[model samples]
Target: MPITLADKLVVAISSRALFDFEEENRLFERSDAATYLQLQRERLEVPAQRGIAFSLVQKLLAFNTPQMQRVEVVILSRNDPVSGLRVFHSAEAAGIALQRGVFTQGRPPFGYLRPLGAHLFLSANADDVTEALGLGYPAAHVYTDSVQASLAHPNELRIAFDGDAVLFSDEAERIYQAEGLEAFQRHETDRHGQPLPDGPFKPLLAALHRLQQIADAVPGMRIRTALVTARSAPAHKRAIQTLMSWDIAVDEAMFLGGLSKGPFLKEFEPDFFFDDQTGHVHNAAQHVPAGHVRSGFASAMVETTATIRKHQDQG
Candidate 1:
């Protein structure tokens, strides 16, 4: 496909759209965590925000200007009427497209209802991004609970992501998280070199694969993706297997076992880097446009409505 503004897109979103995690059992009435998570799985809605992720995206938007030119944003939710409206209006104010619609939870996104062009598309709704990626559109997922940071202008818009959690399966990671790493490792090791079980990010990976094919056809144009994760050695075995099984191609792979990602990404010079962890995002943003992927099963750090009210009051 032609590298349109739609293709060269950069999105920054709030965490709720990216991941589904419970806010603390605080001001609100509490419910069973498992039941709550189960209910969340069935519904396609934005969860609460992670402060760190939100703050980072806001900082990114601050850097958006005429010099940057073509960039668009979609609030991605009907919830949070006020903030959503603010974001929608801001995009209009800046002459960028702001699409508002109900989207799937975690499937890869396809084309959207907008005129074709080169632009950055961002949203707070994590799940909606899967829709964008399914449609072969590039997007960013963010959270509400995030820290402030600079959104650098990219001369070369390189983007990176983790394969399994960020791109492929939640099954293995979920197993690791609940069942213990050893069990997860053993399960994966037994199934090592086996095909992936069609994780949520699969469609997105296919979309990226399509982009790569297009780039290949046209010279002087490039869209590259890197898989960077903590999975190494025996664990890394599964990731490679999954990629091969899916017939997807990743330009780079760095299996850093519990190491900081910032330094290496600094050298690679990606336009954006996305991961499921706050640590990687925290470090990556210092060097490039950074976003956090919101998974459907993560817990959310809920802030009181009063706190949000206070910020609105200040604003």
Candidate 2:
């Protein structure tokens, strides 16, 4: 018999994304590999603090019972093997039950996502995120300074996402960017029944949906998702229709009409939130663990690499 990841919701995350390694990471940034490894070795027994994605990972792992394991979280990091010890230690201290990881030292770690069957990839390193996204994985550049995971909901995993450019294609966004609100509204209104194209996080959403299915039979664990978008009124029809079309359902949806998403996200208290726009992300990060989906048309407006936007339609 052989081990396999098929039929499981697997999340491949970075060491920095899973724990607060900023201080140690700073040491690595300023010094050589030996110095970084030595520092990690010195503090091998000391558990690291929880990073932004900690709560999310912890909750997802809870879906796995003694008899049935529905989720897997693997540490896919750039740290040398010596530095990997603290990561497992930190997970143990947090009671995360994570047992799988791939340590690439300084080499690119995105290549491992394929073999790991990753549904999502969260890394503090933007380059790895970009690479994973390029390789067609749903990857996010976790904003380390964002709001830490909320302790309000321990058993339930709360995840939020932006609609346009985050969950769905930037087609409507392109119109909104090119024309005025009226044109955008009319376009969506005309296409209310039509399903919008899938975005980068759609695959991740589908994977979460599958986990949610498992949670239904499990007693102690649950999954809550929200579509917190800036689109409001008639435009909301298309977003809803798209999810419905895909047979995916979210616990909640906020159509804020181009307003700030911070307060709404605060109320939702997600373990993590994802958005493609900078302003929206910054606002949400102030209230919840946030990640930037470095894809879509809005990202193109920021003068970033066009390659990310070119492959933006992928998940």
All models: lDDT? 0.52, 0.90
Of the candidates shown, which would achieve the greatest TM-score relative to the real structure? 2
For candidate 2, what is the lDDT? 0.90
- lDDT by residue (1-315, candidate 2, tens digit) is 799988789999999999999998888789887888888999999999989998888888888889988888999999888889889998998899988999998899999999998999999998888788778889999999998978988889999999887789889999998998999999999999999999888999999998887687878778999999989998999999999999999999999987789999999999999998878888888889999987888877774555567678674
Worst 10 residues of 1 by lDDT: 19-28
| RMSD vs true structure, all candidates | 12.3, 4.4
lDDT of 1 by residue, 1-315 (tens): 654455333443332433223252221136554544454444333324323333323323333444542233333342334334433444444433445433333333334424543133455555565455444444556533433332343222355786555676566777776788788778778888776565445554565566556443443445567888877677888888888877787889998876888887876666556675556776876765576654423312222444688899999
Model 1 RMSD, rounded to 1 decimal: 12.3
- Total clashes, candidate 2? 0
Count of backbone collisions within predicted model 1: 42
Lowest summed lDDT window (length 10), candidate 2:
302-311
